[model samples]
Target: MSDLPVVVAARRTPIGTRSRAFAQVRAEQLAGPVLRATLADAGSATGRPLDVADVVLGNCMGPGGNPARVAALAAGLGVGVPGVTVDRQCGSGLAAVLDAVTAIRAGDDRPRLAGGVESASTAPTRSVDGVPYDRAPFAPAGWPDPDMVEAAEDLARADAITRERQDAHAARSHARARAARDAGRFDAEIVPVGGVLADDSVGRAEPLLPRLRPLFPGGTLTAGTATRISDGAAAVAVVPHRLRGGAAGLVVRGHAVVGCDPALPGIGAAPAVLAALDAAEVRTGDVAAVEIVEAFAAQSLAVLGRLGLADDDPRVCADGGALALGHPWGASGAVAMVRLFSRLVRAGAPAGTLGVAAASVGGGMGVAAVVEVVR
Candidate 1:
């Protein structure tokens, strides 16, 4: 049996724009259904119920009670299946999946379910002292901790990513997403939740992108060029390659989490992707597919440019990305992996086909994973 960890199933709930389709759903409620669906799909693929060793999840902005355990119980995985939650801001989900992969590679043969969830609409209001705050500071007082938007704006200026280019990139994302959704390319990976059968944000941004004003004065980014705040959950089932039973799946190749200058946090994924690819002994041109969390058009373009990929490279987010699908913070990273699984595994790519999933984190960090298709 190969010691490599293989992902046999991937699933996600329809992404709902904040204060819309999933306004009343809690984080665990959002994660539970996807977890159940992913597990069932894995069981179907393997022809037996897996002895799941753990349930690991990434979350941000939820009520802090170890949401992973709550979500696990909610999925009826039984009390015996312990759960752990991780937080690396937007990169949490992919970090969780990599944690599971590390465990499996370290001689733990039992299967595991890992992913991320977020319910921005239902998150509790937080306060420090007598003042309310949207979120905790990503860096301490001595460190440069600009808001994510501000960081994106700085990155755009530094990279000379213009407003016209950003708008075009966003438009392309929406068009690709709408076309993929229309063709049912996203159907098999989406698990309906909160009565929301499909992503509510797709196909709504392309036409308005060019007309929208910049989010900040004299900035390249606009509301249309940024990912919508959303509610969603995404998960994948991981097990030893031996248990895959010759089924098609993603074989874990390499992963990395690296940090960069805090002031330009949005470009962090570039270094992480390079590191992961180097670890996997693969080059950017060798990758068949790539998925990076599209927090903002300028940010994504900067990352791609750093990695020597063209802005319109079809290999990157071929079916659109967070710009159209919505950004459910913690879930977006895991969502990237799920997208890769769909494009590579579900679409019947040849064995050894390479793919990459990556996300820029809030505190000047990036997380990325390299995976290969195996049958």
Candidate 2:
């Protein structure tokens, strides 16, 4: 245990709908406060101020400057700690977490702050060679690099996922999230941001599911089934197990990142999950909880099928998912981590409970990790 790495604290801001509660907040502004809060929590829990060696944050469409450095400075972490910004698209946040664990595993032993942040409302317009575009090119010319929604539509057609199923799944997500919010289940992990104590994007809107139209012609991926753009930030405090003191959290067991057909990016999570589970020496049945980003209902359903899980598997996103909470792009993966922390630590999940966090990336990639709750 002394040689392993463990999460000491995890916290995330209330997810804000795009152009709504967090429209005016910068990416750094969102991340810095969460980082500070996470550090404060970790410090109190461990009975000492954390000596974080570095800070790593993920961002997608934020400004060109290094947002992680800006966030660390904004958090008043001082000039001693450096920062790195990761850009693995949707997987960036989880990848940042894995990077911190990797550093700890390689004998660094020092604490590190890792998570993600996104400010979709304030994201700068991206362009290729000065030609304004909605997103930067992910693949070279002549390769099938359809937009994410188109890729989800492809998955839906290939996997025979219907609009009905997608809508049903989205509705279930909303109901579960609303129930959790009403029960105050999220209070332990969510840190207030901009005076928002609960996820502002979640609401009772199951009736609106059928009314929303698809992004493409005759496509099944509708606005109600897919996650909308959102703004948020999340932070995790990671340290060697020897330094964890008495705090109970998830022990870093294993991780994997895998690539897939860029044309069907939605299927990436399945393989990544399998690989990570194999590395962790655990089977799907051994997992007590799961958190997979709901990039789209079609893709999420496809991943579930590939992983041999039912659409409503009790172990998968049991509380809710991106479809209900909103997708803050780079921040979502870390949000998944925070969710795991809530379930395995704050919720008093039994010791040795296995949990997994996974996400499908924009460029036909996926990232996954396996963790075990420890006391």
TM-score of each: 0.99, 0.98
Candidate 2 C-alpha lDDT tens digits along 1-375: 568888989999999889998989999889988999999988887778889999999899999688999999999999998999999999889999999999999989899999999999999887778889888877889888999988889999999999999998999899888888888888888888778778887764578998988778888888888788999999899988778888788887889999999999889889999999999999999999999999899998999999999989978887899998999999999999999999789988987999999999987899999999888
lDDT of each: 0.93, 0.90
Q: Please, what are the lDDT tens digits per residue for candidate 1 over residues 186-287?
A: 999999986789999998988888789988988888899889999999999998887888668998788899999999999889999999999999999999
Candidate 2 lDDT score at position 240: 84
RMSD of 1: 0.8
